[model samples]
Target: MAGDEAIRLVSYDPSWPERFEEERVALEGAIGEWVVGGIHHVGSTAVPGMEAKPIIDILVGVRDLDEARACFDPLAELDYLYAPYLPEQMRWFCKPDPAHRTHHLHLVPVNSQRYRDELAFRDKLRSDPGLAQRYVALKRELAAGHPSDREAYTDGKSTFISRCL
Candidate 1:
């Protein structure tokens, strides 16, 4: 996490879905050979009217983890810097660089628990306004408390996410 960025939440932007779509198209053209399920726009940015960190988080479903390694170089060609975070669960990457990220890409196995959980959380946020608002409030509080610590801010949200699931 040497190049990790600070936690800075921003108001919801209507353009996030378009941005995700653009990235999804590029990603599909670049690595469609390995895609098994589909590309999804997840995370807070995917939920309309939710304040988030302003990064379009995309989840790409593949058949297997070992074979997904082939997607690394292709994604890098698209400016996605691969990160070794949660290697056993998913292949994580951030666009441009970790310090100034515009997107987060997660390559997960189609049938993996992590893939299901991510979509579940996003759907829950999308359908439940009160829950989404509460999540935003918690995020704001966490961002304030752990301004420069991305990991801490994320760690603080686990309990809330668990409850939602």
Candidate 2:
């Protein structure tokens, strides 16, 4: 776990998509052929009008984990620190500058279930405003109860996410 910060959900920022696009272009330039499918903006921040933790979650579909790993140096050059937080599932990278952490890159195989689930969840949230609102409420409640516990905050929403999926 990186240094724990209180979970703070803020109203959706209109600039989130632009931020994702900037990162996406940089990532595609850095990793070219390794990226089998296109990059996607997943997670709460991707949904318009959804209150979220202010972190942009990017999903990059690669040919395989090995190919993804090979791009570590390139990604690092872009200031993305490879954090094997979930090594078994995917390649995770986080920006070291916590104060300006505008992105998280999750690298998974193009056809992997994790990749599909994430895209589906994000799409569902975007298409269904009521569902998005319900998710926001759950996040707010969870954040209130587990302000300093990142694990708890994340776990609290598993059920809701599962249901959504």
Candidate 3:
């Protein structure tokens, strides 16, 4: 919860996948049936051996936004705070607390471009160490330059991510 907007990147931890699994089970119990596709671990943390921020990024593929919207209450009951941060394409939710988020849930349509792109990017990074390393380097540079600007830090990586996709 401390330094919520501050950018902090750390070396990869083998525990990230396990943490994702734990969250996945909890999430499945909460709203798994409502989802069209299964949940996925995306982002830098999903890439093994890649340095990243210590937050787990989860992609929940739902049939549509309506189904995703319906998950707000159930997810909240499980400590996932719902936010209409990206209503156009996805429903955003953060776990534990927004101020010190441990997980981020992005609910998008299973067949949407965003969904495919995210998975593709993650898969590419997982398969290619050089690509993953470059991404890690970019993240580190962005974190150092915009330590207090979360939006800028994310925006800075958009280009690289798009290319990777």
Candidate 4:
């Protein structure tokens, strides 16, 4: 699906915290120690008072993508589908087989644009409650449609997200 329909927002669920911990343990064991610089649970789900997509987004930083590449075997063995957003651009991995895999692992090279952008966007949302509320409102509106229509939803929010970025 080229990741277009992956953004499905869900009402804030208290269970998300437990889900994150469960995921962190599984990922740390499956992907090995050094493959991740620091595995962070970012996105709205990570924050305490924000609505978010049901999916748990995990940010895995590495010395380089090569270090992350080594985890492909272990990760896939655990049912994660590895796909790069853009091979020439950067390397990251996720469970295309979402149910089978537990988390969205973005293995970004330290200090890269993509990494910075992810952090910036997430931090902006965290620090500014007004923007977070706006995001929540937009997501609620978007959620009325097909939750799986990732592309349509992302396209719709591009402007709002860009401003936050």
Return the top candidate by lDDT. Answer: 1
Error of model 3, residue 73, in angstroms: 0.7
lDDT of each: 0.94, 0.87, 0.88, 0.72
How many clashing pairs in candidate 2? 0
Q: Which candidate, 1 or 2, has the higher TM-score? A: 1
Name the 10 consecutive residues with the lowest summed lDDT in model 3: 1-10
Between which residue pairs do clashes occur in model 3? none
Residue lDDT tens for model 4, 6-98: 455667788878887887788788765755456777777877688877777887777777666787888777667777566654565666664
* Candidate topping TM-score: 1
- Residues 34-86 of candidate 3: C-alpha lDDT, one tens digit per residue: 88788999998998888888999999999999767788889989888877776
Ranking by TM-score: 1, 3, 2, 4
**Model 3 scores what on Cα lDDT?**
0.88
Task: Tell me the TM-score of each prediction against the true structure.
Answer: 0.98, 0.94, 0.95, 0.79
**Between prediction 1 and prediction 2, which has the larger lDDT?**
1
Candidate that beats the other on lDDT, 2 or 4, i.e. the better one? 2
Q: Lowest summed lDDT over 10 consecutive residues: which window, candidate 4?
A: 1-10
- Pairs with steric clashes in candidate 1: none
Evaluate residue 146 in candidate 1 and report its C-alpha lDDT on the 0 to 100 scale.
93
Q: What does the lDDT read for residue 114 in candidate 3?
A: 93
Candidate 1 per-residue lDDT, tens place, 65-149, comes to 9999999899989999998999999999999998899999999999998899999999999999999999999999999999998
Residue 45, model 3: Cα distance from true site in angstroms = 0.9
